[model samples]
Target: MPTIRKKGEGQYHVQIRKRGYPTQTKTFTKEVDAKRWATIIESEMERGVFVSRTEAEATLVKDVLQRFASEVLPTKRSEQSDKSRIKTLIEEFGNYRLASLNSTQIAKFRDQRLKVVGPQSVIHEINLLNRVLKTASMDWGIALPGGLPTEQVRKPIKPRGRDRRVAELEIAKILEATESLELRTIVTLAVETGMRRNEIASLVWDEIDLKNQTAHLPKTKTDVPRTVPLSRAAVKALNAFGVKEDGRVFALQAESMSQAFERACEPHRANIVGARFHDLRHEATSRLFEKGLNVMEVAAITGHKTLDMLKRYTHLRAEDLAKKIG
Candidate 1:
């Protein structure tokens, strides 16, 4: 039914030739292991359910990831972040063959990553891995006999969303600490319009319509275009810069803005506690709710794709809520 021969020292080669199925061959260190593999292949062939594992068995996880990076990563909005995750995945499971990848291995990776990073970060990495495997099977024509291992693995529990709202006094201290007009303006816009740091940093003068009280965002984190309603205060802040119809609204890039914010917050660490620049967004979202804006109205202004995400950014004060109820 099959042929097994000693190819070299500690090398046993097995070949199976079925009448209706294609020839299959593999090499193992032991004779018994080679025989066991042959039996499985022959049995699959007998049942007319044999799918060649040669390609999947031969391909490495890193090889597929590299291909995905070159071909697919460019088309994605989160290309930069995805690239980082891909690098980590390759570092961890690069040498493993696709056929050898299992749920246990993925589960171990989840547990290991949770030690160094938060659940959300690990979730992104695992989801990326799952996407790569699916692409390998569907687009690259690599067949996985056992289906996707990632599908069987349980993802780490997502942690609760941050509810850190920036207080008025802390905001005042931050604005006073940073004399940079650009940084002050960025902070002001973040609280006024609930615009993300990147969105504010990347905004050009043409995107703003002061007369119409709106700012059109051509690109956002969700890859969706949004028009944000500007308050009177937001308009006044923009007017402070004067007319520059062609350039970015802010002088700093996203990372530079974050660094500058951190530096500004250094002196007021005790007063601010855990206040991050992003808390301005939370503060803005909560204020919108406190002003009697409905869910749809707030979502439209904030560019939040889901009510759940919008809720994460909103942390209304109970005292204010009680006033409304009374």
Candidate 2:
């Protein structure tokens, strides 16, 4: 028998006893809520599908944490990335019973998450959760029903890449503003090598081989290992550091670098004309084409995996193309 008592404030005290399951009592804010809970418990008990909160709590935390601890942390991903992503999932979807989190709930969750975080980040977090949920369903049998993201969610469109080649005069102004030797090295490396910001920040001495004129980048944004051939400008920029042994070449914060790159280009923005630092990759590829290199050679230089990926960087203004045709 289950006992219900009025506990003030329209609340109820619920107590239930069964032979196999221990006696449980809890206070609820509303009588209807209590009744709803009791009904679920009684029905689950009849079916032998009841799980006590105390017994299942540890499994939920462990199930979520194992992915971060084992799969994410061991990889060369950015330091805060794994923690940030896992925190988002746990904060939003944490309290629900793992067994009850289903396709409809996940869809609602996807919409809720997209409102706050970028749609792209929502997609990423959903993908991460799917991994955890899938493992729980298949490996541990913890009761997640299907893959999250049964349908593709739209990602926010990042603006078209500005591939403006910094003109020789504008490059001069940027070089002048880059007074700090470190900033100079970073800017020079970015323009010369076309390395992404994270790749540049995470660069290590072990990855460099000045003797062979190449850098064996162990990890990249694309998760593909690539060896960037050292350009003469890159070599000159590195020399400014002088007698470099080991440790990070540019320890500049990723955010700070982008800020400074923006500031340095402020005066010459009209000349370079709506190009971000990443556009340097496109600019670098344009330089390759101007120098008469073929498509295969340009792909080798830029580390683009496919011709389609390569084309995204190749936005040729009609004037520039006209000059080439002329």
In lDDT terms, how accurate is model 1?
A: 0.89
lDDT, candidate 2, 39-94, per-residue tens: 87777778887666433333554455455556655564543675677777777667
In candidate 2, what residue range of length 10 has the lowest lDDT sum?
A: 143-152
Tell me, by lDDT, which candidate is best.
1
> lDDT tens digits, residues 1-326, model 1?
99999987999989899787778889999998998898888888889888889999999999999999999999877899999999999999999999999999999999999999999999999999999999999998999877899999999888998898888888888888887878777888899999988888879988889999999999888889999999998888888856587877778988898788888888554245677888889999999998889999999889999988997888989999888899
RMSD of each: 2.9, 7.0
Alpha-carbon deviation at 72 in model 2, angstroms: 2.9
Instruction: Give per-model TM-scores.
Output: 0.86, 0.67
| Residue pairs clashing, model 2 | none
Candidate 1 weakest ten by summed lDDT: 267-276
lDDT of 2: 0.68
